[model samples]
Target: MSTWNRTGPVVVEVDGSAEYLRIVDYASAEALRCGAELVLVAPYSAHASVSPMMPGYSPKAPAERADDALRAAVAHVRHRDGYATELAAVAGEGSRVRVLAHAARKARMLVVGRSRSRGPQRLMHAHTNLTLASRAGCPVVVVPASWKPCLMDRKVAVGIDGTALSAEALEFAFGTAAGREGDLTVVHAGLPAEHAWNDEDPDHSWISRADHLLSETLAPWTGRFPNVRVTRFLSSRQPAAALVHESSEVGLVVVGSHTGALPVDPVARRSVAAMTCPVAIVPHHVTATDHERISAAPRRPARRAGRSDVLTP
Candidate 1:
């Protein structure tokens, strides 16, 4: 039998980097907050990349390197102010996404480190994150390698359109904010071209419409999490840019992505690349196991149904 639980441990990727302690730190804090176990995963190939052109390429066997990485992460967690949230480390042999997805089959959430690589390298890295998020069957958090503990760590923001796509993301954002005892910022960015201006009202009308949309979307969550303060922001800026801007002031930016066949929207792709803080990519759909868990949770109150000026970018 698999160790997969509907509300399982928080699984994080351990990439064998000397700086990966930061990733471990963030994940461990999240695990502690949710009272979930923290499982560190390191994926490596058994075969070493040996080449005749460069015989010096052999550093160490991939398995050995993975073991070393897991050991270091375990030690880091153990030494962190006497951190004691149930922890486990696994070294799996396979591709990155495959191993991590399997490890987090039905986990509470999956966390991974984001690469700062630019140009083509950055695109490739983003694709991997997207795939992982889709396959993990749980929320996936991509934390920047440069992330450090800061005052903004408690601040969380999420992007939403007037569609079901953002429903799951909203839930994650509100839950996270509640856990941190922090405020939640809800951003709705609309393109000027998408709306028609009238002589009766121009800028103010669009702003009002956006505000109304956010109010409707957030009604259920606000009632459920009465303690979480919310800030509604409406802007004419591009969706991706708007999210990236908010990321500078927030610890986490949550965005919804389509699961299965559909690719993540362009806004999510761009935000992940430019965000200054960690980004949580929540899929719109959930696995059967997750449905079982959610079915038992408190049901959210229904909201007034109607579409507004929220663009589905």
Candidate 2:
């Protein structure tokens, strides 16, 4: 089998930026646990081509650039190898999206960096990471530019709502904790209610159910993974804000995805947006159409501090 196998290959888009180096450490650790390998598909795409915009442009420079990056990135990763990896660079046909899309095929997941949002420009052009996440055949993981988190060995944190889509997160958290030989913590954030049909104060009901679900709905999971820890938080604020706050002390944070759902709902959108830690998004289910819209969109670079996209930066 390829070094990057059917399991999590951790296809990371490497620009060879100092900021992205942490991915090697994170990937190596995870691969060791899952018996998977780490792979590097460094797509070489340059926006500064001086040639004409037409179809017959020369491919030499871009091809060579990719080759160089692949050699360098592979060397760096090998120096830290904890798992087998396929280190190769691809000259993205027209855009970076092409190569990343290809890499996403049969790979466990995609991890990319987030451009600090600048303003309207960012909104329109978008970031390559979001593009991949929105379009990849599998779930895309966005690691912040300066993100570095510990491995999942003990204590787990996952966000859950009352929906079936949210339930997928439990699998990742459980599997991760088990791989670590440690405990698991499952957290659900929402306003509470009484019976399935009963209506009560959302805040009061949410807190009540948060405790109840841990004891009831997740009872079987507790037994499945000994030393499991769970807490339910009532959230009335931004979903991401609540998750971020609760997960600050955790090694890894998992959030379920409803990316291809009818609306792509607000929760899933916030789950991936602006998160400063390594994140695993379990997309409930997705289709090719979703990937197309995600990859075809153009992306602008991270804007300067004064840009409109940043409110407080």
Candidate 3:
């Protein structure tokens, strides 16, 4: 039997870095507010730092350090929040990323700090955040150090353009919303007005059909998630621009890596580069078995474009 709960459990992943703790604090507070349980993974390991002299030591040191540090972090969290959190050192691993992916099986959402804290003038590292979101199984929430968790409708957002790959994204998003007890927004963008009803054009029907398809695609999920509010919006701008624009108000945005027979939107792929929030590129084949949640996940295959982005308070 799988340890994974079909109901929903929000998982917050951390290295317990100062930056990550801030994120955990923010997310935990939100979870508490939403009446959701927080599962904290304080890996006893640390990623091996770059050192030619200690190449082999890099892999093992992080596990031990992460385990110890995570326990301390959990203790602090318990004292501050009035209850102890479920903490895991994440037993075995091929790598930190790989371990987390496996643990994600039982989680509705995976939370990770986008990057370490930086000076006021510093910017976030797109590569790190992208890798975490792209590879994670569940919808990955990239919490920033400066992020202020507020009680708003701006919960998780999933982008779907009527593709099977989108079904994967929606399934993950719906499960995450249920876990968080948060609202969800479905955003779709079509061509400019000229292409909206130009039935003569080869792809005109593609744009025209979005409204109905968007409604149908989400129909089954609505009844299953009455408490998790859903909103559908259509834009006449380019897919990437509109999606990125919608992300400005969302805590996270979920998009299909590639949907059905169509390749993932290049702009949406790149739109993540400039998105105001974290974007999880949900893959089509993510699944896990029993008890412990998988921590690291398979890396998102190389995308055609490589722009990524993040922000802070």
lDDT by residue for model 3 over 262-293, one digit each (tens)?
23344544555556675665545434321122
TM-score between candidate 3 and the true structure: 0.66
Alpha carbon deviation, residue 80, candidate 2 (Å):
2.1
In candidate 1, which residue ranges exceed 4 Å CA deviation?
1-6, 51-58, 81-83, 191-204, 286-313
lDDT tens readout by residue for model 2, 11-32 = 7777666666766556655655
Best by TM-score: 1
TM-score of each: 0.85, 0.70, 0.66
lDDT of each: 0.80, 0.56, 0.59
Q: Distance from true position, residue 4, model 1, in Å? A: 16
lDDT of 1 at 54: 85
lDDT accuracy of residue 52 in candidate 2: 70
Full ranking by lDDT: 1, 3, 2
Cα displacement (Å) at residue 233, model 2: 3.5
lDDT for each residue of candidate 1 in 35-135, tens digit (9 for 90 to 100): 99999999998778777898767678899999999999999889983666899999999998899999988798999988879977876787678778888
* Local lDDT at 115 for model 2: 63
- Say which candidate scores most in lDDT: 1
- CA RMSD, predictions in order: 7.5, 9.5, 8.7
